[model samples]
Target: MSKIIALSGTKNGVISIRKINEPYGPGSGTVASVGISLSGESENPEWKVHIPLDNLDEVIKALSELK
Candidate 1:
């Protein structure tokens, strides 16, 4: 099975960061992804974001500033 590394667990949800090592196989592929996952409630839905490593800092900053 493919390996998945979980950096931390949170009450809100969890964040996963995977480091990609290539040549992964035949076709071209991504280098890495930073993800933010949220659990669904009765009215909401579960979702995950596959964020580019370069944009992670900006995204995190924006999220942190949310009120």
Candidate 2:
């Protein structure tokens, strides 16, 4: 699954979320990827982070707590 969102305060910026399978090659497993692109190019993000599926829940909880 994947999603794209317009970034606040920027005309052409965007944020993208996706599930990547074996992003680091075979055996790397799947990951939840979050990316940001100030240039509006979701395929080539200026910043990105990959969260392991095993840690997703905890990560979400932590992020929520910050809100």
- RMSD for each model, in Å, please? 7.9, 0.7
Where does model 1 exceed 4 Å of error? 1-46
Q: Per-residue CA lDDT of candidate 1, range 1-67, in tens?
A: 1233333554455445555443246553544444455541312324433455566678879989995
Segments of candidate 2 deviating more than 4 angstroms: none
Q: Which lDDT tens digits does candidate 2 get at residues 17-51? A: 99999999999979999999999999999999999
- Give the TM-scores of the predictions, in the order they appear: 0.36, 0.95
List the global CA lDDT of all models: 0.48, 0.98
lDDT of 1 at 51: 52
The pairs that clash in candidate 1 are none
Error of 2 at 37 (Å): 0.2
User: Candidate 2, clashing residue pairs?
Assistant: none
lDDT of 2 at 55: 97
